[model samples]
Target: MDFIDEHLNHIKDKGLYRDFKFFTSSQSKYTSIDNRRVLLMASNNYLDLCADDRLKEAAEKAIYTYGVGSGGSRLITGSCKLHDQLEKKIADFKGAEAAIIFNTGYMANIGTITAISDQEWIIFSDELNHASIIDGCRLSGAKVVIYKHCNLDHLQEKIKIHQGKKRLIVTDGVFSMDGDIAPLDKIVELAKENKILTMVDDAHGTGVLGDNGAGSVEHFNLKGDIDIQVGTFSKALASEGGFVVGSKSLIEYLRHKARSFIYSTALSPVTIAVSLRSLDIVKNEREPRVKLLENSKWFQAKLRKLGFNVLESKTAIIALIIGNAAKARKLSEKLFEEGIFITAIRPPTVPDNTSRLRITLMSTHNRKDLKFALERLKKAGMELDVI
Candidate 1:
């Protein structure tokens, strides 16, 4: 009669149990997966900066200087010299008047949205916004209206309908599931006419979009117009932690009023150092983004040529849509056996009948590796009767 056991039983029946894969080596183009050397296409190490020597050295130097771990919460004792320096550098990189760091991208979204808005604010969110944004809306107790994903017409209609209320418009800079981008330029114009505050969670967009990976805000040239820009260091940055970039007043308000930032232990000195180095690496080495785009375009075009249902992607995320969850899982397993690695995304992560084999590319993968993956994909598609 317990609800927990009932859900567990249902999950077991559906073959939907989830667990982590313990990697015995650093993340890279290839990994020691399930006792076999497999080509890794599932990682978020987009620009292949995770294994870069600069970041490694930065962390090592910090550990030598500041020791391991921040011992207390930021407000009481954990804000180290490195954390302050990192924040300043991030602000400069993001073109924000100021920036504040947080423990994770999830907490940054959760804490900031909750801190800045309240029940009286009407939060208009994209239908496909990430879970963190959804949870943030709930925590804020805001009257949330969901607009169809990336449909500016629907968004505009909702804006006009809800004209009298204090409004906040939020969206994912790059929607994680489908690999498509938000119409930020039009969204900003709509926000301006309606007098709304705008926030974008650029977790996957930071090191993938714009002329040189400056993110969605920069891609749309809305640097100062965006009320908040939340980003993660875990993806293209190849590090950990999150930051909110905005005006000095907003940054200061979150620094003091955001409970998650106030109560949580600060990012360790080594993490701060690694992220700082990543910022340098991402900006100074522009070749990775170029190579990344080439790799993604190659795979996407080939997948379509082979008749697989590859979703449209402008960034590093690519998805092969397979309608049935069981079939999607089978496709992933078959691909793994063929020495390719990918993740199978299913319901709740996406809607029903929209299961997909999510493939992410890195700049480290070469042309031969690219051709090898395409061959394996063709074989897998043929075996699954998908082609």
Candidate 2:
């Protein structure tokens, strides 16, 4: 207990202590926090479908038909028609042979990585992959070699240095923090040349990238090239759960080997119904995705013009580096006071001395909303000397 207090104090002193903001309203471009309507600029609901009528209707219908909870795991009585349908739909969407659903994206990554690799396998991972992917690599007992973030030459060098009969190259399609896209096409080329399997966790890319919004794989036109593709419905899809799509053998193997999937209770039928409906909506509705990316580009440029250190990005996520943790937190607080809500990302989420404001845009954020945010950010940045 004394050690716990010491650790808490250390983090607090470092401005790395995190707490939650209770939202009284549904997630969208604007939400109620502490009864005050705040412009939300930190959400991952890229398509802005979290509170969509269609998704709500689907959830209600599923609830009426299938009740609430999934009473067991997937292999047991929990597997329902909705679950099977969603898996099939996801497989078709990603152009994979089959797909398996997990309770969360974290579970999907952790389960898939650990299920596929062992001490004999060497996993070449991107340095900036999600924590879930990192945790998966740690749990897998594989020799995890981290290449420079999205640096192909470094990855290639590592691949050559650590030759293995069973090897995998895993990366996030769009990095969640920095918002930069991975060179999946080049990665695929490297994988093929080196005879290594490839996996892409397109959690941030799905429903927000490519011509058809099929994710970074589609953006790179490398469909069916990746051996194991992982994604989640929690972000852009505006639903719940995570999934892995690949060959039928891979899916079958995961069912038997992935401990996270085998033991966890399946996602609720309601969530599955919402995911199914959202998937249909996202596939057809291309305008929102277009507007979202366009807005991202426009907004990031505006921030840079205002003298903020905005990171270059192709997705809806943007990272504005503030460099110091306490200053970053102060900037976030100043923005909150101006009716804008952007989370200040700090160490371990990012490297030390690279604290940043993780600003994410929703499809519903129009020019007016963005302008308001810009004005507030400008004022806050001036006050906090962040610009």
Candidate 3:
């Protein structure tokens, strides 16, 4: 208790202590949190499918039919019909031979990386990859070679240095913090040259990238080329599970070998049903994706024009680098006071001296909402001298 208190106090002093905001209403453009209705710009619900009426009805139907919980581990009795259907739907959407599901995106990364790699193989990962990927590499029993974020030349150099060894290159399709995309075309080409496998954790890309929301591989037209493509339903798909799409054999291998998938109880029936409905919405309605991207481009351009250091982000996620943790926290608090909710991302989620405000756009956000947020943001930035 003393150690916990000491560390917590230290974190608080550093302005890195995190506290959750309780939502008193559904996930929408304006959610009631802390008894105030604030415009939500910190959510990952890029397509705004979380509170869709069809999805809610589907969830209700599923709950009425299947109950709340899966009784045991998936390998025991937890596997349900809805789970299989959702996997097939996701596989088909991703244009893969098959797909396998996990309890969450973190579990998906950990399970897949550890299940596929051993001590003999090396993993070349990007320095800015998600924490899940970092932890997965640690647990994989493989030598991990980290290259500079999105620096293909450094990756090539590392690959040359580790010649003649079985290797895997893992990266995020859309970096969660930075929101910049990976160059999958060049990565695939490099992997082919070295005969190494490539894996992409497309957690932030699923249901948001590509023509029909097939994610980064599809966005890059490299479908069936990347060895493994991982995504999560909790993001754009608006559900509570993760999936990996690849060859049928790969899917089978994960089903048998991935401890996270094998040991964890399957996702609830309502979640599976809601995910299925969300997939249908993502596939059938192209307007949401179009609107979301347009809104992102407009918002990013507006932020940049206002002199905020928005990094090279072309996706729904955007970051305004504020450098100091305390300042970033202050900016976030100011935005909250202005009835906007954007989070301050500080170390160790990001490197030291790179703390920033991470904002995300949703298709459901209107022009008025964007205008209000922009006005509030400019005011806050002026108050803090960030602009």
Quote the positional error of residue 9 for candidate 2 in Å: 0.4
TM-scores for every predicted model: 0.97, 0.99, 0.99
Error of 3 at 268 (Å): 1.0
Candidate 3, residues 135-206, lDDT tens digits: the string is: 999998999999999999999999999975679999999999999999999999999999999999999998
Candidate 1 lDDT by residue in tens digits, 54-167:
889999999999998899998878989988988998888889999999999999999999998898889999999999999999999988999999999999889888865578
- Measured over all alpha carbons after superposition, the RMSD of each candidate to the real structure, in angstroms, is 1.2, 0.7, 0.9
CA shift of 346, model 3, Å: 0.7
Q: Clashes in each model (backbone N, CA, C under 3 Å)?
A: 0, 0, 0
Q: Candidate 3 regions off by >4 Å?
A: none
Report the CA-based lDDT of candidate 2 relative to the real structure. Answer: 0.95
Screening candidate 1 with a backbone cut-off below 3 angstroms (N, C-alpha, C), the clashing residue pairs are none
RMSD (CA, Å), candidate 2 to true, equals: 0.7
For residue 160, model 1's alpha carbon misses the true position, in angstroms, by 1.5
lDDT of each: 0.89, 0.95, 0.92
For candidate 3, list the clashing residue pairs, or say none. Answer: none
Q: What shift in Å separates residue 363 of candidate 3 from its native position after superposition?
A: 0.5
lDDT of 2 at 89: 99
